[model samples]
Target: MSLFLEYVKIKIKDFFSYRFTLFLFLLIDIIYIISLSVPFLIIYSATEGFPNWNIYELFFFTTTGIITSTLIFTFAIVIGLDITDKIKDGSFDLLLLKPVNIYYHMLIQSLDLRNFFPDFPLFLIILIILYPLVGILFSWINLFYFILIIFISCLIFIGFSGIFISFSFFVPHFDSFWDLFFSFREISRKPIDIYKNKFIVLFLTFVFPFALWNYYPASILMGKIDTSIVPSLVLMAIIFLAIGFFSLKYGLKHYKSANG
Candidate 1:
């Protein structure tokens, strides 16, 4: 844990050490979030609003999606790429020999210190604005559950990436997995119900479990989710994490130094 903390501290120091990089990232995140909101703004203006949703409601929805995406990207996609890059350069071989668990080694090294500045501030700002309008119970217990759900979503995504990472050990062409992952991620960016397709909704919500990232939890606040569905989502997350763990263990046996 100390070594991991050192990695985090170094990332934080580096983020502040370079003022210009920090500003650029800050600008990019702001612009990206603003631009992405345009479609929702247009829909709100044209139709007045979606049924049971208003401009501010949609704003909260999209903002929450952005925060979830950023958090997942920081932990999963970013770390997955770091693993890929290290594998390509054969640097991962040294890390594999370390006393640390390879999973933890991969997870901690991929931390993107730069993204925290942009994503977290925006998350807080949106959260503060939407708290009153979210229509939840608004108690400390509720708040804790909400935060826990989002954290679980991050675990689900990291599990997904960990499973994807396992492929590199067997498959020569593995980078394309990122594209497939992103395409799947696009589905979770909005309320899964908006699709209007019952099969897709059920599959995503139950089978693939992408909705664990935002939809299921967001629906809890919207007063739309079924109480019975909550435990199932958490169970799905645990299952995926286990799959990722066993996959890595199996994959490691076949791993050879990239140089060899």
Candidate 2:
């Protein structure tokens, strides 16, 4: 925790050093987040939105996506990218020799405090806006489940990212991998039920499991589904996490230092 705090302090100082750049990026992020809501508004304005989902519900769903993606980008993807770079330059060899557990160390060291600052305020704004529309559904137990699912979803995303980062141990140049992963992640932004094709829905639900990111949890929180599914979600996270762990270990076994 001390090490993590030290890294956070460094990041805070560095972020403040370039206040203009920080604000510029923050503005860009906010704009991008607003842009994501445009499609839903346009669709709803043109026609009835997304079968049963109202505009506010759709916005809620989008907010959850923003939360999940923002956290994943800050915690998982950034660290994975750093790990990839270190692997390419052979600096990962030194990272392994550090006294701390490699996973915890990399996670803390790669913490981009900037990427996390926007989500809380944005979420609060959304909650305030949504309270009138769907506030009746809110309860402490439901909120707890919602938060728990989001936490597991973040871990699942991190594990999925780990599976991709493991490939860095083999290939020297795989920078486009993150783009490919994000491209798939885009599927999680919308509800799977919107797709007419059963096969595609099943594929996403089971093969890729992107639905866990927002759909399942959002559905439960919104009272569209039963909470009994929480156990299943936890199991799925465990499966993915275990797969990611072994994949990383396998890649490590094959890794050859750049110095060699």
Candidate 3:
């Protein structure tokens, strides 16, 4: 944790050194996140709300998705994209020499401060705005579940992105996997319950598990499901993380260094 904090401090210093660029990026991040919610706002205002979902509930769902996506972008996809370049340049092997846990080192060192900032703070602000509407339902238990869900969501995201990142070890030019990954993750923008097809719902829930990133957690907070389901969710997250870890390890074994 201290190592992570040190990296964060460095990233903060570097970002602050260029105040104007930081401001511009922050502005862009805010605009991009807010733009995603605009469509939901339009839909809610224009039509009757979805059967079980009210506007606030849908807003919470959207906010969770944005947070999940942004956290993934900052932590995993960016590092995965960088890994391809590092492999091509024969710098990927350097990670093996680092004293820290390789996965932890990769994630901490790849901290992209700009990608994280305004989006996170913006979400907090949105939640603050939502408090008046949701305050009564915001029990300590709900907050605990929400935090747990977010932690698992991030793990699931990293695990999925790791699969793509692992390809870089075998194929140095595999950066396009991030684009494919992003396209799939965009499905999280809506709750799976809105879909009518059972198979599609199952696929989204388990195969890609995009629903975990937003819908399941949001539903839990909205009291649509019992907390007993959390254990299963935790187990699922671990499974995904294990798969991603092994995939990357397998790729490493197959890797032929660019320098060699």
lDDT of each: 0.73, 0.76, 0.75
Candidate 1 residue spans exceeding 4 A from truth: 97-100, 133-137, 258-260
Where's the lowest-lDDT run of ten residues in candidate 2?
251-260
How would the candidate models be sorted by lDDT, starting from the highest? 2, 3, 1
lDDT of 2 by residue, 121-231 (tens): 666587568757864456788778878888887777778768877888876687677777667767767887887789867766666767766777677788877798788
Instruction: Give me the overall lDDT of model 2.
Output: 0.76
| Candidate 3 lDDT score relative to the true structure | 0.75
> lDDT for model 1, on a 0 to 1 scale?
0.73
Top candidate on lDDT is: 2
Put down candidate 1 lDDT per residue, 84-140, tens digits, no spaces: 767666787878788988778777767786666767777769767886776556556
Evaluated at residue 65, the lDDT of candidate 2 is 65
Q: What TM-score does prediction 3 earn?
A: 0.86
Per-residue lDDT of 219 in model 1: 65
What is the lDDT, from 0 to 100, of the residue 64 in candidate 2? Answer: 73
- Supply candidate 2's per-residue lDDT for 179: 79
